[model samples]
Target chain A: MLLKKRKSKEDTALFRLEENEGEIVLWSENREVSRQLSMIDLQEEDLLVLQKLRPLVKENIEKIVAQFYKNLEKESSLTKIINDNSSIDRLSQTLTIHIEEMFTGVIDQAFFDKRSKIAQVHLHIGLQPKWYMCAFQDLLLSLISLFDETIENREDYNKAIKATTKILNIEQQLVLDAYQKQHDEIR
Target chain B: MLLKKRKSKEDTALFRLEENEGEIVLWSENREVSRQLSMIDLQEEDLLVLQKLRPLVKENIEKIVAQFYKNLEKESSLTKIINDNSSIDRLSQTLTIHIEEMFTGVIDQAFFDKRSKIAQVHLHIGLQPKWYMCAFQDLLLSLISLFDETIENREDYNKAIKATTKILNIEQQLVLDAYQKQHDEIR
Candidate 1:
């Protein structure tokens, strides 16, 4: 059958991130993100809600990222992993991009792969799962507050919140699986 | 429970080969290699054979790689995809390393991902699946001949052949899945 071939391309930037002198927070406890990974049905409604939140997330990206770092930096113990202001700057940018990507509305195999890599990186840098989990929670709350303001109806706001939470939970689970996989490998 | 951490890494180099100045061969038709892919059992016997054959495949690596290239070059039309002598040399070296890697006795998810990338590259380069199938056939023969020479017992040799074939079949099936996925995506 005659079919036009699209140029196949693959970029594993996720795996390429080396042990840069950036924010590498070391927490005593790590969560196995991979083991906790389970398929959450991202229905059409969820996709719609996510897409709607994209602009709001984009607008608040800087503030959201700043606040996340602020929370992380407040704990003097955590600042040890931050390396320097330059590292925080880079990480803030990365976190912003990552958050922007989440709003793409379609999470495929590639998405999971990136999350898996992130989980591995956390393990590599001695980052605790608790911190990562808390960071995610903070991101969600930031988004939710914005979401609440963006939506007029209480019912719609609740639905959007539910959808957003489901997707984030799914992402968190996948990330944890990396920790689980790593833990298994080391054992 | 305390556990040691293992490093995680992934490289999708197979799909990274873009339109480099080289050979391009086009047959009138492309096979649905993906449709041809189905799960083939990899028995313990197969793993044993693969482990045993590892050194032999290694020993004859030069001869085997030469034969593979010779087969590819024989088709004057396919030579269009090979850029030059340097390209051929580089590809030959890569093929040798890849073949050697297969004998590592464990085909994990990472292995499948690499093979899948290779399949996608074939489609992207407009190389027909027929060539891959033929190349694999050539690889099988080269190994089988070596197997025949290395093993004194015919019965053991037959068992080894059975094992090797099973493993190769599994690899072929994975490569085919890429085609199937791409075909579905385009349609």
Candidate 2:
């Protein structure tokens, strides 16, 4: 499937930033933003591959999210982090949106902006990178299993998983960047 | 101090790719490379901060690397991995070179190509991401201590450490990308 060029930032209404003051203060807006879409090599082909998974993800998002939180809940420390900073209901809804967004395949400046904001929220909640990375690994495993069961064609399944991995890494990079910025600001 | 724009890919020769067949096969060459220097928002100023630390890193690299490996030696699993894959002396020398490269303050395609090769080597050695990250945290702590003791001004120390962290994260992202590629290739 041929994927069109990414739409202009103004063309997309999906990744709108909230006007909340806490979020504004938390967001690292002044940092010199660069072209991230290129950095991770997220190509139009990768986006096309991801767009194809939209239906698969939409159908299984609830199950996928449930599996993710179940794994997170296995550790008491992670559970405490959630209880202290956010409720399960709130996090579940947010994550469902996040999963759907991954398959939207419409990356733009706003896409990175949203990831940046999420990264800040994670920082505010005192989520350590190790735990975050661990959780993401679990999520990736779940997605791989989902694709394996759902997608019969071997090549297509590989393409789908590969595409998913790239988008997830992009998300993780933004989080890592935010974590570094927080460290820079702490003193 | 004003910094010059990044030098083109051809000018300097710090990060030369090796001609070893194993190295060539391991390096993910056909993968579409992106402008990562921008992706991580690594600027000339960060390079300038790192460049200023060249002498400091140069003088104490031995001590810093010794501390890093000493910390690793405490972990039996890490020691076993080193024993199985490589000797401490060999790894130590490679790490010393790696740490010095971090402070060289030069980044271009060759710089990234070199990092990509290192990531492949790590995979070939069966070094898990968890262990790799744990080791990196130790190295960063050593550098932080080095900066804390040697750099007089608090602000300069912070800038140096932040710059170091960005370059390190860039390296990590490349590894993560390579790891994902390996997973994609595994079947």
Candidate 3:
């Protein structure tokens, strides 16, 4: 037997697992999304793993963010660009929220929708793809290091990371398309 | 002539660059430290690059944060972790400050000091390293993708990342040491 529930967004994604099964399965538009995307089936041990890693990620994010700003300030070229509008307080707040949300995971349709909107926002601003990729790599490496202990099974951990990277790559491409379309419209 | 300056906590360790006089000049206390710690000198173009990317990063971070909290709400095992803590707001505030500072090139000694303290607090609570690392990686990836437009050269970008990563590794080790020493004392 299968259980189905619709998430609020336009995607109408469903969370599924076998009836009486310990894990949950996720489906979108009558097709199965990856199990990793489905949170319903997370076993007790899986939940424990996520719980254990959340705060460490939060803390390290704070550190990486601090460092990123410091680099921006010191670089004379980057300074003038931000001189008019940016502030340490504002940037820090933005990063904090972002990092916090990563651990918490996404559940709401509104939340996912907001992310789609943010992708549009990036297009308005003219972000380059390479820069986005570089930043992602740095952030990923730091995060992996932070969770080095809890990920006792290096192979599984690596697989999880590869999966994440793949998803992120897709997300990046989508944003890039949105950005290009916006740019063409403006031109 | 080499310009000597007092090391600021915010300053990346100095390294060797060919001087105008064609001599190798040391930028910091030690060659290795300098090599490992130097930040990219910002140029006007780089500033423009960063300016374009900043907002996207900001937007992405916020979206990620929302999703994170939503996921936490859905999970049974994680809810209690936040039961007694009103600290999420405080943490968010600190994170905002931290990210902004990264772009501004200003080093906040107080901020770093606070994070170090927070690490201790987590350690006291028995938070594992893996949790922090996972969250950190997630945030890092999100922000990186947000800033994809500003990165010019992948090689230089990767080098800078390596430098930053090394510094973070050092910082994490220090925090771990402090926590361990304190833990030992409590015992």
DockQ of each: 0.01, 0.02, 0.03
Put the candidates in DockQ order, highest first.
3, 2, 1
Worst 10 residues of 1 chain B by lDDT: B1-10
lDDT of 3 by residue, A1-187 (tens): 1111221224311121122222222123311122223322323333333333455556567776876666545334345544444567776787678655544433334434555575675544443333333344445555644434334333334333433343343344334444444544565
Model 1: per-residue lDDT, tens digit, A1-187?
A: 1111221223222112242222222111223222122122345456555665566678779988987877675455456776733388788888889988776666556776788898887777766544565466556656655654455443444455555665666665566646656744764
lDDT of each: 0.57, 0.62, 0.42
Whichever of 1 and 2 has more TM-score, that candidate is: 2
Better of 1 and 2 by lDDT: 2
- The residue-level lDDT of candidate 3 at A6 comes to 28
Q: Model 2 TM-score?
A: 0.45
Model 1, position B83, has a per-residue lDDT of 69
Q: Write the per-residue lDDT of candidate 3 for residues B68-176, one digit (tens) a residue.
A: 4554454333445555554556656656655543433222354346556967777666554433333444444444333223333333233333333333333343354
Model 3 CA deviation exceeding 4 Å by range: A1-52, A71-79, A149-156, B1-187
Collision pairs in model 2: none
List residue ranges in candidate 2 displaced over 4 A.
Answer: A1-39, B1-187
Output DockQ, candidate 1. Answer: 0.01
**lDDT of predicted model 3:** 0.42
